[model samples]
Target: MKVIMYHYVRRYNPSLPHFRFLDVENFKKQLDYFAENFGFVSQSEWATWVTTGQMPHQPDKIILTFDDAMSCHYDYVYPELLKRNLWGIFYACSQPYLTGKMLDVHRTHVLCGAFEGRTLVAASEEVVSPDMIPNREREEFTSQTYRNQENYSGVSRFKRMLNYFVDPALKTHILDKIFEHLDYQVDSKGFYVSQENLIEMNNNGMIIGSHSVTHTLLSTLSLDQQRYELEESFRFIESITAQRDRTYCHPYGGTRSYNKDTLSILEQLNTDYAFSVNYRDIDDTDFVSSRQTLPRYDCNLFPHGLAS
Candidate 1:
């Protein structure tokens, strides 16, 4: 079985085009490719696979999942999926829905888009301490500490520096300051899916899952904090979906981003399966271990054979 992950799906707008934002045309093409080449798995099918160890009869089955609950998923992706009678698992950050605040990670993306060409130091100087900016020689050292992403290049390197190495409090401060400096208004309408959107999606046969409250790196947090993150987010999802067959996806889902304690917390919360961004082929070893840390492939790595 193959599980694919996506972040954003929207029409291309030059002003704020996020590198990870897959354009609507390409997204449709990818879905077409999937429909032709593989069997689509629904949320219930995924649940049964995890709980009963029953693989789908088709060898080429694929499950679709979206992270961060971007409004574009509701606006664009959802409608397209409905047209095809396909389903996707949407893991949402509860804080955005509950408090109407933009996520820090999203803030980083906004700032990066607004200040695309500026160096990290120049962009962050006003809000971040000069000492926090690593010198040219030490930049590599700093990047290494952050689990340096696979396709880290161009603006993505700067994004990684701000996302991973910088202090969270300071990072939020810097991003907020930058957003203000750019006179940028974060379009809350386009930033996240509202509760109404969640309920509508659930009613329309989509699976809603938790992506934590603050979307913080769970492994960096203490056991109790991790528990709170998981429990509170799970509760919010239950309130909306009214179902306890909970599913979760890790924030910054590196192997190091979650530990055994995180899995224990998910088990306690009655979470059925937890997805991670770890890139690997799912094998017997994955099933032998707990289902909580199932591996996923980023959409970029979809096999060549599966492409047109």
Candidate 2:
């Protein structure tokens, strides 16, 4: 079986043309392809594989997962899944609801989308403080932080610099500087689904899971900080969802985005499954694969996932 991960799934807003998002129509086409090739796995069947590491002798099985719990998942993806009687795990962050502020991870995405990469790069050059310089080599940092991005070359580089080179304490500060330099502000409203929306989805059989409190890279945080990120986010999910499943999708979903401490924290939290963007099929022979940090392919890697 294969698990596919998705983020924003709404049609590209004419307002944010540079913002990379999967169109609804293309998503529908992907669904058709998956239904024809790999039938969507049932909730119980997937649970069995997750719990007992035993999958029935079925090669035509797939699991759909959505990360970030963007409003687009509720507004666009949910109805489409409902139409096909398909289900997906939607991972959510709690900071927006708790603080009414956008997360830095998402704020950077919006800012990176709003302006040209050259423009953002120039702005970053001006705003990058001496204190913010990374301790390691920049090229190595970019290579690891952003291995294979779908963004245009320039934007991808700028994202890598911002994502890795800056200290976490100064990440938002530098982002703010770039936005100020561009004379633009990232809008915080309605970017994510509401608690009521989560409840409705849960009541209707959709599964909900935690992403993190602020979507920071878990590998960068201390043990207690990691625990807080998972615990706080899961608490919010439990408050809203009727589902009893304990699952989490890593913030960046990359292998290096988490650590041994992260797995330990998940085990402590009694989380049954966690997802990472390892881009591989789930092999029943590899019990360790699904046990923790389960692999997931980005939707863009599959046919009909990207616009022509």
Candidate 3:
């Protein structure tokens, strides 16, 4: 079986074109390909198959999953999926829904788009402390990560650096300053769905899963911190839907983003499965091992040939 992961899926806003995923028309084309060539599996069926040794009757079965639970999913992706009688698992960060604040990642995306012309150093100077920049470690990390990209710009590299290395509190402070400087307000209507929307989605056959509370890099946190993130996020989801699938998707989901302790915590919490961003197909052997680190293909990797 194959699992496809998506982030944003709405039409491009001119002010924030970077937040756009595949547009509505191309997204429809991708769905058309999946529907024509593969059998769709509901979240329950996929979870059962993961927990048990059983395989679905159809070998061509595939599951769709959306990460970050953007409002775009409710506005654009949900109606289209319903039209085709398909369901998807949405992994949502609980803090935004609970606190009615925008995710820091979304704020970063908006800031990057708004100040695309400015280099990261230049942009940082306007909002962040002078001490934050010119760190030897930060420069080294950014250089190593983007060394292969021939056309990578300073702004892009610095944005990536800020995401992984900067302290979360400092990052938020810097972003808030930039937002105010630009006269931009965080999405006040909420970037993620409300409790009502989650319940409605659950009732309509879609599955809701925890994507952590603050969406912090799990590997950067200690075991107790990881436990709090996992447990609290799961509790929040269960409180809303009154159902527990005990499923999770790693925040950031890179190789170093989660560790063995994270899996241990999931096992203790009775989590059925956990997904990683690693791109590959799932084999039957994966059921016996690697359920917690199961690989999923990012939808952007194959724009034209998802089913091929």
Candidate 4:
């Protein structure tokens, strides 16, 4: 069984742009292909299959999931999913749902406009100007207190800097301005599905899972911190829906994002399943944990691959 995940799904409207956004036309192709060739399931369905040892008859079993609950997903992807009667796992950070806040790191990434430098150029045909340049200097200015640029590149160092400061409200404000600039129509910072929306998803057969409270790097945090992040997220979700499923997807589920210790902590927290990002599945091991750390294929990678 090979499960795939995605983030954003929207056409590149010149009016509003974002870093993780994927073009809507390509997004349609991915769904059409999967509907024709594979059996689609939700992440929670896979958990039931794994725990109960039920084997799906289909030769190719695929699960669909999205991370961060970006506004684009609500605006574009949700309607598409509903139109097709397809379900998905939307892993959301609880802090925002409860308090309307997000981790500073994400705020920095959005407000800092990291994409404006390289990604914006790649996304658009327009030539970037000095005045239109992204705010790397402001990112550096805010992050220098904790980041050591001599040893790390700006983006890498700023992430580490954000981990040191833990305040959901502060991060929320920074992201507010960023999203506003990205789309002047709405000030949709910390744009996550509301508690009511999560309940609707649950009632509609979609799964609401955890993406941590603050989207912190699990590998960098101590075991206690890691466990806290996972446990709190699980508890918060339960508080919202009164559901028992405690699934977690590492904040940045890339290959090097989380390690063995992180997996061990997930096990310790009694997380039913965990997810990570990759094109292939991790080796399944008993002591290690479930290979449920599923591979998420970024939709932007379509028409070629991740590099494209």
Candidate 5:
């Protein structure tokens, strides 16, 4: 079976033209495309596969998963899925809702969207300390970090500096400084689906899963920190959504995004499975062995997934 991953799904943001996201019109078209060509596995079938070791019979079936639980999912995707009687897995970060603050990772996205790369590069240099900027070449960094799309030439170094090299506290500080300098205000609370929306979706057969507390790289944190980020986020989601299934998707999914400590924590907590950004089709072999790090194809790779 194939699994498809989605992040932002909304109409064109005229104000933020550079911002990259799946267009809602295209998303509807993609659903139509899938309905005509492929079978969709329901949430119950997915749970059965996890627990009863039964594979979905449809040869060309697909499981839909939405990450970040973006407001667009509630606004556009959820109602459309409900109309078709389809279910999906939505992974949400608890900190954004609990603290009512923008995540640093998303701040990078906003920075990239609101301003041009050259402008952002200048602002990043002015806001952050000299030592914070890495000595790495832009091409080398962007080649690895953003292989799927056009290399963000000017912004790549800026992204690398904030995302990887800087300390988390300092990263947040730098992002705040830049935002202040640019006079850009991100609507943190309105950015994601609310607890009520999650509960409604769950009640209607959608699966609500944990996407960690702070949405930081799990591999960068200590073992105890990783455990707290995973388990605490899981508990928080369960309390609010009454989610019976225990599943997680890595904050920034990649091989390096999670470690042995993460897997160990999930095992101890009796998690059913986790999602990874490995980019491949899942088969019966993966069901038997690689439940924790199952791969998913990016929505951008499919027809009608990207804006023309």
Candidate 6:
């Protein structure tokens, strides 16, 4: 069995090309491939089969998962999954959904949509065509811009204050505008799946899983803090799902983000399982492969377009 994770999926609409997510067509092709190629199983079934040796007589099974609860999932992925009668899990970070805070980042994301490919410094350059320059050159330009400024002594003194009240990169075409929007949203808003959204997602067979309340890296925090994060996430997710099942996925499950101590804490919490972003190695014995450290392949990484 293999588990696959996916993030953004939507049409690459140019107007909001920042929101130009994975085109809906490519997303559909992946789904079709999943349906035709292997048995799609829920996380629960996969867990059970791993431990109890019970499966529905299939040669292979794959589990699908999505992270971040991006609005794009609601607009694009959900309908497609429903149309095909597929089930999956959605690991949501609770903060953005509760407040329109996503608008904070998203708005910045939009304003600077054109700067997506450029570095933070290049995006700050005054030139109209910043993207034409390479990242290293852009860094040098921005460094020079900062170096040439005279009133920046006071600016540096109150840097945090300025970051909070105003976006410094507000003049770089689309980039600055995007940051402005995000700043406005984060300071004054919140976005969460409405109660209705949660109920509907569950009813449609999507299991709700925790991605932490604040999305902090668990391994980086103190032991107590890590435990608190794990427990709080478990309770909040269980409340949202109205299920006794407790499962969690580490944020940035890549090499540096999750480590042995983090796994130890999760084991103590007795979480059913936790997923990591690490990929491509699976063996039958891998079933017992540390409940707190399961490897998952991202759909975006593979050629067959299957997520796991």
By summed lDDT, the worst window of 10 consecutive residues in model 4 runs over: 120-129
lDDT at position 42, candidate 4: 53
Candidate 1 per-residue C-alpha lDDT over 159-205 given as tens digits, one digit per residue, 9 for 90 to 100: 66666656554666777776776677777655788789989999988
Q: Give me the runs in candidate 6 sitting further than 4 Å from their true place.
A: 18-20, 42-44, 50-59, 97-100, 103-116, 122-192, 303-308
- Writing each residue's lDDT as its tens digit, candidate 3 over 87-173 gives 988999988877877777777766665555354456666766656554446655555442322322555655665676666657777
- Per-model lDDT: 0.74, 0.82, 0.74, 0.59, 0.82, 0.58
Global lDDT of model 5: 0.82
Clashing pairs in 2: 253-277
Worst 10 residues of 3 by lDDT: 143-152
lDDT per residue, candidate 4, 236-269, as tens digits? 8887765556678878676455777777777777
Which has the higher lDDT value, candidate number 3 or candidate number 5? 5
Clashes of each: 0, 1, 0, 1, 0, 19
Candidate 5 has a TM-score of 0.93
Residue pairs of candidate 3 with colliding backbone atoms:
none
Candidate 5 per-residue lDDT, tens place, 1-308, comes to: 78899988888777786687888888889988888888788777777888876878784588999998888999999999999989899999988878888778887887787788888888887888866654345344445564565535777677777776666557788888999888888777678898889989999888999999988878778998998998889888889776667889987687767899888888898888899887787877877677788888888788898643
Stretches of candidate 4 above 4 Å error? 13-20, 42-48, 112-115, 118-190, 242-244, 281-292, 301-308
Model 4 / residue 145 / CA error / Å: 24
Better of 3 and 6 by lDDT: 3
Q: Which 10 consecutive residues of model 2 have the lowest summed lDDT?
A: 140-149
Per-residue lDDT of model 2, residues 72-105, tens digit only = 9999999988988989899989999899988888
- TM-score, structure 1 vs. true: 0.87
- Tens digit of per-residue lDDT, candidate 6, span 57-77: 553567778876766677677
